[model samples]
Target: MVTIIKGKDRAEYPEFFTQLFKLRYKVFVEGRGWSLPTKHGLEIDQYDDDEAIYFLDVNEHGIIEGTVRITPTVQSSLTADYFSHLIENGQSPRSSRVYEATRYIVRPSQKSRDLNRAAKSRLLAALTQWCLENDVESIQTVIDSNTLPTFLELNPKVLPMGLSYPYGGGRNTHGGGDCMAIRWPISQEILECVRLYGDLSLLHAVDAISSENIGEMIH
Candidate 1:
C-alpha cells in the first residue's frame, strides 16, 4: 500500500525518512549520477522543506519500494525555482492549486518488469486520489523522453510546457536524456482512468494520512 507523509509529521517516522533518503541516494546519485547535495549517503535538497509532501509505496516489511515528492507551487518548487526556463513563454505555474512533483524513484530490488510497472501505477493512482481530494488542479514536473510516453498513456491531458533539452551525459551529472517540463491536469475522470489502468481500488490502493490522524498511525 501507499503511505502519505507530510513534512510536518516527518519527525514521527525517522527510520522511514532515513530509508527514503538512502533509496534516493541509490537511485539519483549512484545510479543516475545526479550532482545533488548529499551528506552521509543521503540524497536531499532545498525542496524537502515543511511545505513538501511525500508519497511512499512501502512493502509489507516496511521498506520503501517507490516514492515521490510534491511541493506546492505557491511556495518554492523545482519547476518555478529551477526549470522556469523550460516553460514555454516563461510562464511558470505559481498558485496554491498547482504543485510540482519530483524525485520519482522505484527500488531495483525486483528484476521483474511487471512488478516495477505495477508499483509505478500504484503511485500514480495514489497521487491522483490525493490531488482530487485536496483540490489540486494540476501537477508540473520535468521528465525525460522515456517517461513522457508513459504519462501520456495514463492521461491524454498531459501537456508539454516547453521544448525538450538535452540533460545529463558528459559534464552534466543529472542523468542522460532529453527532458521536458510538462503539466498534467487533475480531475475525477483522470483519477478513474488511472485507477482502471493500474487496476487499483480506492479502498486498498492508498492510506492517505493527515495531521489529524497522524498520531494514531504513529502510536
Candidate 2:
C-alpha cells in the first residue's frame, strides 16, 4: 500500500515536509548508505518550498516509504542549480508548461517493492493524474546510468533529454550509477495507467502549499 501526498503552501503542510525528510533520511542516508550531512536525519534542500509539489508514498501504518519532488521548471528554477556544466546553453527558467522531477527516494523499510512492476506502474499513474489536473505537458527526470534501464522499463517513450554523467559518485546509476537527464510526455491516459497499479491523490494547491497540514485528494 502506498500513500501519496501533494504539498501545499509553506505553512499548511509542515508535517508533510518533516515526514518527507524522515523518509529521505531513511532511504538515501541510513538505508542506501549515502553519507550526506542530513540535518535532523532527513534529506532536504533549499529548493523545497511552497511552489514544489511533493509526491509521498506512505505505508498502511502512515509511515513514509518513498517520495519525490516535482516543480515547475520555469525561469525561476534553472537546471544550472543541479546540472549546469553538463548543458552548454545553460538552463533557463521556463514556464513553457514543463515540470522538473527530482529527489526520488525510497525508504529502506519499503525496498521490497522497489523492483515490483505493479508498484512502479501505480506510482506513475498518480504522477500523471497530477500533471493532467495542473495542465503539465512535459516531465523531466535525472537518472543514474544503471537506473536508466529501470525508467526505460516503465515505457519505451522515455527519452534522454540532456547530458549524461556520474552524479554523486554515480550512486544513482545501475552500473556506475552516474546520473542522466531524461524526459517524457505526460498524458491523462498514461497517468491513469499509473493509478491502476497503486494508490494516488490529487492534492489541492492551497492544502498542498500549507506547511502545517499535509493531505491528499484522490482524483
Candidate 3:
C-alpha cells in the first residue's frame, strides 16, 4: 500500500523515513553514483523541506518499495530553483494546483522482475489518486528519454513541457544529459490506466465503479 506522508509526520515513523532515505541512498548514490549529500546512511538534501510531501509505497510488511516526492510549484521547486530553463517562457510554474514531483525512488522486488513494473504503476496510481482528490490539476516531473517507455506505461498522454534540455546544466550523470520536463494531467485516462495495470481501485469514488473489474483487469 501507499500513503501520503508529510514532514511533520516523520517523527511518528522514524523507521519508515529511514527505510525511504536508505532506498534513496542506494538508488541515487550507490547505484547512480551521484555525489549527493548523505548523513548516517540517509540521503537527504535541501529540497526535503518542511513543505515537501511524499507518497510512499510499502509492502505488507511495511518495507519501502518505492517513493515519490512532491512540493508546491509556488515554493522553490526543482524546476524553479534549478531547471527553470526547461519551462516555457523561462518561467517556472507558481501555483497551488501545479506541483513538482521529484526524487522518485524505486527498488524492484527480488522475487519477481515483472513485479517491479506493477510496483511502478501502483505508486503512480497512489500519487495520481491523491492529486485528483486534492484538486491538483497537474504534476511536473523530469524524465530521461531512455526511461520514457517505462513512464508511458503509467499514462500514455504524458508529454514534455518544452524542448529537451540538459538537466543540471549538463552536469548530470546521464552522458547526453538530455532530459525533459513532463506534465501529467490529472485526468480519467490516468485513473483508468492505474486501475487496470496496478490492480487498484480509485481512492476517490468514481461513477459506475465495481470490484469485479479489478480482478478481470489485472495483467
Candidate 4:
C-alpha cells in the first residue's frame, strides 16, 4: 500500500529518505540519463534540503515506488531563477495560492495493472489533502508538455497556470527537457486523480501531464 510521509521522523519513515535517494539515483540519473550530480548515483539538489515536503509510495515489500516534492511557491525562485521570461512576458501567474511541485521520481518496479494507478491517485490525494488543511488554493508545478493532456484528461480542474519553457542545460546540466506550470484545486479532482493513479510515477504523470499525450511520460 502507499503511504504519506512528512518531516524527518525516522521511526515512521525509517530509511525512507535513503530509499527515496536510491530510487532517484536509479531513475533520474542512471535510468533517465538526467545530468544530476554524481558520487553515489543519487540525484540531489539544494531544493531537496529546503522547506520541501515529500509524498512517498512504498510497495508491500517496503520498496519505494515513487515520490513527489512540494515546496511553498514563495520559497521557490521560479520567477527569478528559471521562468523569469515567462513571468516578464506575462505568461505566468504570481499568486499566494500556488505551491511548487518539483523533483518527482519513481521506481520502475511499481509499474503494474493496479499499483501504478493506485500510487498516482494516492499521491494526488495526499497533496490535495495538504492543500485543503493548509488553506492552499492552487498547486503549481514545473512539468513536461507531453503530460499536459493527461493532467487535463486525468484531472481537468488543475488549470494550466504558466507558459511552457525548456529545462536543464549548459555547462553543468542535462538537455532538451521542458516543463510548464499547472495549478490544482485544493480538493476535488486533485484528490480523485490521486485516488486512481497514485502508484503511477509522479515523474511519469508530470511528463504525461506535459506531452499532449504522445510519448511515454517520464520525469
Candidate 5:
C-alpha cells in the first residue's frame, strides 16, 4: 500500500526513511550515477526539507517497493531552484497550485522485471492520487527519455515544457542524455488514466488508507 508521509510527520517514522533512503541511494546514486549528497547509504538532498511530501508504496512487510517525492512549488522545488533553464523562458512552476514531483524509484529487489515495472505503474497511480487529494492544479517534473514513455502513457498528450538539457546525470538515458522538464494538468482524468493502466489490484490504500496489511485493504 501507499503510505503518505508529510514533512512534519517524517520524524515519527525513522525506520521508514532508513529503508526508503537506502533505496534512493541504490537507485539514484549507485544505479543512476547521480551525484547526490549521499552518506551512510542514504540519499538525502536539500529538497527533502519540510516543504516536501513523500508517497511511498510499501509491501505488507513495510519494505519499500517504490516511492515518489512531491514538493510544493510555492516553496522550494526541483524545477524552480535548480532546473529553471529547462523551463520555457525560465518560467518555472512557482505557484502554490502547481507542484514539483521527483525522486521516483522502484526497488530492484524484484527478480521479475515485469513485476518490477508493474509495481512502478502502481507508484505512478499513487502519485496521481496524492495530487487529486491535495487539489493540485498542475504537476511538473524533470525526467529523461527513459521515463518519458510512462509519463506519455499517464498523460496521453504529455509534452516537454522546453528544450532538453543536461542535468545531474539523467536516468537510464544514454550518457546522462538530455533531460526534459514536463508539466501535466491535474484533474480527475489523470486518476482515471492511472486506474485504466495501473495494476488495479494494487489500487487499495494509495490515497486515504495506509493499512499496515495491504492485503486487508485489497478485499
Candidate 6:
C-alpha cells in the first residue's frame, strides 16, 4: 500500500515519519556515505519542511519499503539552490506546477535485481498518479546516470537538464556512476506507461491514496 503524507498532516503520523527518517539515514548516509544533517540517527534536511509531500510505499506489515519526497519548485528546490548549473542553459524551472523530487530510496534488503526494479516501478507509478491529480506538469530530479536507462524505459519523455558529472565518491558512489538532473512531464500517457511497466492495475495505482483510506490507516 502507498501512503500520501502532506506536509500539513505530518503531525498526525509520527511513527511513519520516524521510520522514514531512519530508512533515509540508512540508505543515504550510512549506505551511500552522503554527508547530511543527522539527529538521533535520522537523516533530514531543510527541504523536509511543511511544503514537502511524501509518498511512502508500505507493505502488509506496515513496514516502509520505499519512499520519495516532492517539493514545489516555486517554494524551495534542491536543484535551483545546489544544482542549478545542471539545468540546460542554467535555467532552473521554478513554477507552482513544477515540483522537485528528491530522496527517492528503496530498502537495500530487496537485493534481488528484479524485486528492486518492481519496487521502484510501483513507487514511480504512485508518484505519477499523485502528480496527475495535483496538476503537476513536470517533475525535476537529480539521478544517477546509470539509472537513466531505467527512467527512459519507464517513460520515454524524460528530458535531461544537463550532462552527468562525477559526484559524491566517484564511480563507486552509492547512486552509481555520474549524476545528472532530468525532468519528466506529467501526462496520462506517461502514467499509463508507468502503470504498464509496473503491471499495476488502474485501481491499485490510482486509488492507492484517498482521504477515507488514509483515515482508516491512521486510526
Q: Candidate 4 on 184-214: residue-level lDDT in tens?
A: 6677656665555544556477766678755
Candidate 6 is scored at a TM of: 0.85
Instruction: Please report the TM-score between candidate 1 and the true structure.
Output: 0.85
Error of 1 at 161 (Å): 0.6
What tens digits encode model 3's per-residue C-alpha lDDT throughout 1-219?
888898757778888888888888888787766678899989988878778888998888888878999988887477777767777745456777988898897675664545766787778888888888889988988776567776776688877777777654465554335777788888767888866665434322432355536777878
Candidate 1 deviant stretches above 4 angstroms:
169-174, 200-219
lDDT of 6 at 89: 54
**lDDT of residue 41 for candidate 5:** 91
User: Which residue segments of model 2 deviate by more than 4 Å?
Assistant: 1-10, 13-15, 31-37, 75-78, 87-93, 107-115, 169-176, 192-219
TM per candidate: 0.85, 0.71, 0.81, 0.72, 0.81, 0.85
Local distance difference test scores for all models: 0.83, 0.62, 0.77, 0.65, 0.77, 0.85
lDDT of residue 160 for candidate 4: 62
Please identify which of the two predictions, 2 or 4, would achieve the higher TM-score against the true structure. Answer: 4
- Return the lDDT, model 1, position 45: 92
* Error in Å for residue 202 of model 1: 17
Cα RMSD for candidates in order: 11.8, 12.4, 7.2, 7.7, 9.6, 11.0
lDDT of 2 by residue, 1-219 (tens): 444454456466677678777777776777666555578677876667557877776667766655668877863243546665454334443556888877776543534543454456655666777788888876876666677776754555676756676655675433245656667678765665454433323323433677445445434
Report the alpha-carbon TM-score of model 3 versus the true structure: 0.81
126-160 per-residue lDDT for model 5 (tens digits): 77778888888888888885678877866785658
lDDT of 3: 0.77
lDDT of 6 by residue, 1-219 (tens): 788899879889999999999999988888877889999999989999999999999988889988999999999798888877777755656888999999998763557665676787788889998999999999999998889998997899999988988876679656445789999999999988877776645434645766447877764
